[model samples]
Every structure is written in C-alpha cells, then in structure tokens.
Target: MSRATATATGFIAVLLWALLALFTVGSSPTPPLLLNTLCFGIGGIVGLIWAWATGSVPQMRTVPLRVYAFGALGLFAYHLLYFSALRLAPAAEAGLIAYLWPLLIVVFSGLLPSETLKAGHVIGAILGFSGAALIISGGGAGLSTEYLPGYLLALLAAFTWAGYSVLSRLVGSAPTASVAVFCIATSLLSFPLHLMFEETVFPTTALGWASIAGLGLGPVGFAFYVWDIGCKHGDIQLLGTSSYAAPLLSTLVLILAGIAAPSMTLLWATLLITGGAGVAARASFSSN
Candidate 1:
C-alpha cells in the first residue's frame, strides 16, 4: 500500500478504538481477563475465516515462529499489565500512565531507519499528551507514592504497547494474517489468567453480549490488522500523534450514548487533541 493509504488504514484503528470504552462499559460485570478471552477468541476466528477466504492461510506458514511469539506475547503482556495497573491503582492515574504509548510511539519511531524526528512531530505529540492528560486526570491530584507499584505497571504497559507497535515495522514482512494467530494465542493465555484470577460471569444482557461482539469485530479485531499495516508502511510519527484523538473521540461517543455529559474539560481536550493532530498532519505533508 502507499504510505498515504496505509496511514489512513491505521487511523481506522483509532476510530474503532474510540468505541472501546463504550463497548467495555456496556459489557459490564464480565471480568477483564474473561472479556479479553472472549473478544480475542472471536477476533481470531473471524480473522482466520478471512485469511482462508483470501487464500492467505498458506502465507502464514512462511512467517517465522518467533514473529508469532512476539506478536502474541506483546498483546498478552500489554493487557496483563494494564489490567493489573487498574486493579491496583486509581483508574484515572493508571489510565493516564498507560496512555503514554502514543507519545512513546512518536518518540520511538525516531530510532527507526529512514525516519526523522521532526519538530512538528514532537510538538504535536506533546500537545496531544497534554490533552489526553487533561481528560484522563480530570484535574485530580496526581499519583501517590502508595500506588507506586501500580504506576510502574502502568508505565510498563505503555512501553510494552509502544515497543510492540514500533517493532512491528521491523517484522513488516510478516503476513497480516498472522495477527489471527496472535489473537488466538492471546486468548489462550488469557484463559489461564482468567481461570486463576477472575470469577466466570457471562454477559447477562443482550447489550452486554452485543458489546463484546462489537469489540471483537471492530476495535480488538480489524483494528489490529490495519494497525499492523500502518506501522509497517505509514508515517508512524503522524499515526502516533493522531492516536491521541482516540480519547477525545471516545468521550464524544460516551456523551452521544448518554453515558457522559459535556463539560469544559471536554471542550479543551477536543481543541488540543484535534489541533495537535492537525499540526502533525501538516508536518507529515511537509516531510512527504
């Protein structure tokens, strides 16, 4: 794909991710690990079906096992750390820390071959981070020493995701169909974790089951595939900076769903995140 096309594909993931919070909220009472299992399982199955239909199943055999291992471990580790962080720390604080992946992606992309760390990319990333920080923190008093472990875990989660995304480019030759295996492996790993840690609670409502399906089909499923394409061929720095829009769009989704009310904080966040993305886009155009 052309860089522009790949970048657009990657941004679709961000759009899908905007619905993540809403779907997760709707799928209430399902423990995180269990939810992870179900969603990944569904995503994996659908991906496999697509691979088969497109005759990409054979291409999967050409992919190195180590690549599959990396993809699976990356996905599992990220969720594991993120869930643990939220369980141990305040959600707001933990979330803010975990959300650092986007900025990290922008920074880390600088190290990639042929990529330059432009001033606009850095400035835009900072602006995006500032906006995300506002939405996540809600102007609350910041982290406490008491939750140090949780904060650390959250930070690790951020690094895990950022590293995964950037390193994905190194394995750009891997077939996108391999992501199905990653999803399946992640689901299998979550099974043991869920069995050990969480009580089984199936979705009791239609909305809950529908929400889980929505997640599997959109955010957790196709999002990853497109993201792989973007990271491999797109403007990684611009993609990273624009990812900040996820939170802003997510809040807007919540408001539309009547789950959240509009506020000044939301307004400011919208401006900062949107403007940051605009700046990043302009920089990307200049570089191109």
Candidate 2:
C-alpha cells in the first residue's frame, strides 16, 4: 500500500483505541490478566478465521520464528507492565506515564534508516504530549515518591511499546497475518499468568461481555494488524504524532456516553492535539 494509505490505516487503530477507556470501564471488575486473556483470545480466534478465509495463513509460515516471538513478547510485555504499574500506582499517574509511548515513538522513529526527524515533528510531539498530559493528569503533574516502582514500570511500558512499534519496521517484511499468531501467543501467555496471579471472574452483565467483544474486535484485534502495516510502510513519525488523539477522542467518547462531563481541560486538549497533528502533517507534506 502507499505510505499515506498505510499511515491512514494505522491511524484507524488510534481511532479504535479511542473507545478503549469506555470498553475497559464497562468490562471492569474482571482482573486485567483475565481481561487480557479473554480479549486476546477473541482477537486471536477472529484473526485466525480471517486469515484462513483470506488464504493468509500460508504467509505466516514463511515468517521467522524470532519475528513471532518478538511480536508476541512485545504485546504481552507492554500489557504486563501497564497492568502491574496500575496495580501499584494511581491509575491517572500510571496512565499518564504509560501514555509517553507516542512521544517516544516520534522520537525513536527519527533513528530509523532514511527517516529524518524535523523540528516540526519534535515540536508537534511535545504539543501532543502536553494535550495528553492535561487529559490524563487533569492539569496536574504530581507523582508520588511512594509509587516509584509503579512509575518506573510505567516508564518501561512506554519504552516497550515505542520499541515494539519502531522495531516492527526492522522486521517490516513480516506479514500482517503473523499478528494473529502474536495475539494467540499473547493469550496463551496471559492464561498462565492469570491462573497464577488472578481470580477467574467473568463479566457479570451483557454490557460487560459486549464491551470485551468490542475490544477484541476493534482495539485489541484489527488495531495491531493495521499498526504493523503502518509502522513498516507508513510515515511512522506522523502516526506517532497523531496518536495523541486517542486519549482526547477517548475522553470525548466518555463525555458523549454520559460517563464524563465536558471541561475546560478537554477543550484545551482538543486544540493542542489538533494543532500538533496539523503541524506534523505540514512537516510530513513538506518532506514528501
């Protein structure tokens, strides 16, 4: 696919992730590991089915074992650190730290071969991060010293994801079908972890179940597949900068659903994120 098209495809994952907070809230009371197992299980099954139908399963055989291992570990490790961080620290602080991934992606993408990191990209990333920080922290940036471990884990989670995204480009030849294996492998890994550490509680209500299904079908499922394509072929810098929209859009989703109220914070976040994306787009256009 064209770079622009692939980048657009990758952005779809960001859009789908906008619903992540809502679905996660709806799927609550279920432990993170169990939720991870269930969501990835559903994602894996659906991905396998789609791959089979589209005759993409054969393509996965040609992908190296290390590629499979890397993809699986990358997905599993990020969630593991994120969940662990939240367990140890306040959600808002931990989430804000974890949300550093996008900014890291923009920075790290600069190191990639043939990719130039322009001043606009850096400025845009900072602007986007400021917007995300406002939303996640509610305009405060205080982090408790007692939660040092969690903060560290959250930082690692950010690096893990950004590294996973940037490194996916190194293994750019891997087929998107291989993400099915990654999801299944992640599910398999999560199952043992859940059994070891978490109680096996299923969702209590229809809405809870629907939420999990929605997460699997969109954010946790197709998002990864398209993201692989984008990271490998699209403008990774632009994708990174645009990802700040996920949190902004997520909050808007919550507001629209009546789960949250509109605020000045949201309004300012909207402008910062929009302007940041616009600046990054201008930079990308100039480069092309």
TM-score for all models, in order of appearance: 0.78, 0.78
**Model 1 global lDDT (CA atoms, 0 to 1):** 0.77
Give per-residue CA lDDT, model 1, range 136-229, as digits (tens): 5654446355777776887798889989988977875688899999999999999998999889998899999999899889888989888878
Q: Name the runs in model 2 displaced over 4 angstroms.
A: 1-12, 81-100, 132-156, 226-244, 273-285
Q: Model 2 lDDT vs. the true structure?
A: 0.76
Candidate number with greatest lDDT: 1
10 residues in a row with least lDDT, candidate 2? 135-144
Q: Kindly give the stretch of ten consecutive residues in candidate 1 with the minimal lDDT sum.
A: 135-144
Model 2 per-residue lDDT at 170: 80
Q: Cα miss at 72, model 1 (Å)?
A: 1.0
For model 1, which pairs clash? none
User: Which pairs of residues have clashing backbones in candidate 2?
Assistant: none
